[model samples]
Target: MTGPARSHTEAVAAVGRALAAYETQAGVAADAALVAARRIATDAAAAQADRQRHLERAEADLRACRAEPEARCTAEQARVVQEQHGLEVARRAVSMAERAVRDLAASRVRFRSEAAALITPGRTMTSVKGAELEAYLSSVGLRAVASAGPGSSSAGPVSAQRPSGGGGRDIGGLPEGFELVALDLVDVPDPVTGRDQFGKGYSPEDMAWAFSAFDDVVLPALRAGEGSEYFASLDAAEGRMGTRSYSDTYSGFLGSDAIVLEARPGGRYELSENGRHRFWVAQQTGRPTVPALVRR
Candidate 1:
């Protein structure tokens, strides 16, 4: 309660206020430093996370690249399979076409042969299975002309005639007594010399080449003829010429009988000795039967 006492109290209170202010300032400085440190730590953690994500993405890309080659290989294989299927389809088409040509050719031979057989001098008018043969010939692109025969007409113009039914189908059905002989690739003989000027002997290699030609060219040619708009009006159907097995050792018939030119499997060539000779004779006379030539 004295003046001196009051001044001392004021001084003490002032000293306390100064100490509190110092403590507050120290606390604000410490909080600011902690906030700065926290911000730095957050930024560092975000950077680390981003780097990890980038690394993961890079690894994923590397894996994808590694798998790409195999994927491409698989795609190539699929393309090859598709191409093989297309080739098989084309091969089957060719085979069917050949069959049509063979059938038509055979019918012509038979009619001519029968005509010759009926006559002593091998010259006479021959008739075939009337409606059936006519239809077949028509389908195969040959129209019957009662007015003439082979020597009687060239590929020249004749009187107006009805179109024949020569359209043929794939020969999946094997006819009785006929066998699918070896597919023969007939060679175009050297115009001057009637020999196989391309290869040596009638070995397997030669046969292979011949058959390949038949499959690739001759067969296709026959098919084209069968399907041609002009040729389709003939009556024709393909049948087995012959089939020869590799087991048969005697290559005796090669270059001999036209029928025995090639053999297929299942004893397609040489139905009988007499039949073979007859077939040979038929071929020589120009009444050639493709199937008969096969000799099975």
Candidate 2:
């Protein structure tokens, strides 16, 4: 929202491309995780069924054996015991599979929340006009296409439906009340602060490459642009930044919070987010400005 239209629009375009790629990647990944979870669940169910059948047969055989308590324990009794144990193990496996599927389902629900941060015109901006609307409408065009289905002449105004495109990482266009402004993450000069994830060091970006498409769009565009050392520092070679326990960017389709920024009394657009980690990462990576969605 600062700089000339050239940078803002260009920045918007870059973020747009990045978000589009991310949405694609997120969708594909969510689908894959679901498939994996379902497959495991199905396998677990089958195994449980098999074990149940074996246990039932074993129980039948044991019942058929009229064993005197003082005489001896028949082989059928031992078989029954083993089959019961097997059935228990199978039941545990089934339980674990079901749990994984549930977690994956929950992760998928947040995906839309993440995407809405950037594309959503918000409740306030719905009534505004001109470039802001134009830019919003433009971004909406990207998301609305795949969704609008064929024969739709045009994507309707964003107010027609809630926008959901960019992930929570970028603040392209947020809602109104507080002025929703686009700040180029790459252009933000000062080191922004949040809970530091870099003290022990950081994980390499490539690890995230496999999990998300941040690399596919943002990295390439930045590399092609002014060619800042910001990206040159990606710890691809070492496979890490430093000691780390948590997942890095793009580790999964974890529905993250938007990079919300509240203006301090000074009126400086330097305040900060629900997406604190993301904002910190952007500033650390030499990109705290362009892509951020902020409320002024």
lDDT of all predictions: 0.33, 0.44
Q: lDDT, candidate 2, residue 67?
A: 51
Model 2 root mean square deviation, Cα atoms: 14.0
Report the alpha-carbon TM-score of model 2 versus the true structure: 0.37
- Candidate 1 TM-score, true structure as reference: 0.20
The alpha-carbon deviation from the true structure for residue 234 of candidate 1, after best TM-score superposition, in angstroms, is: 99
Task: Judging by lDDT against the true structure, name the best candidate.
Answer: 2
- For candidate 2, write residues 1-296 as lDDT tens digits: 33353444444444444444564566678779889999999999999999999999998877767554554547888999999999999999999999999987766545533433333332112212222534454665522122221111122222223333321122122222322223332223344454444343334353233222332322222222312232222323223342221123322212143344554353344535444344455444544232234554
Write model 1 residue lDDT over 1-296, tens digit each, in one string: 23443343333334433433443354455446555555555555555555555555555555565678645454445544555555555555555555545554455444432322233111101111222333444576654443222211111111111212211112211122322232122221222132233334243343443333322222222322322221121212222112222111111222233233333353333233212332333233343123223332
Estimate the TM-score of every prediction: 0.20, 0.37
Give the distance in Å from residue 16's predicted Cα in candidate 2 to where it truly belongs: 2.4
After superposing candidate 2 on the true structure, give the runs of residues whose Cα lies further than 4 Å from its correct spot: 1-15, 67-73, 118-296
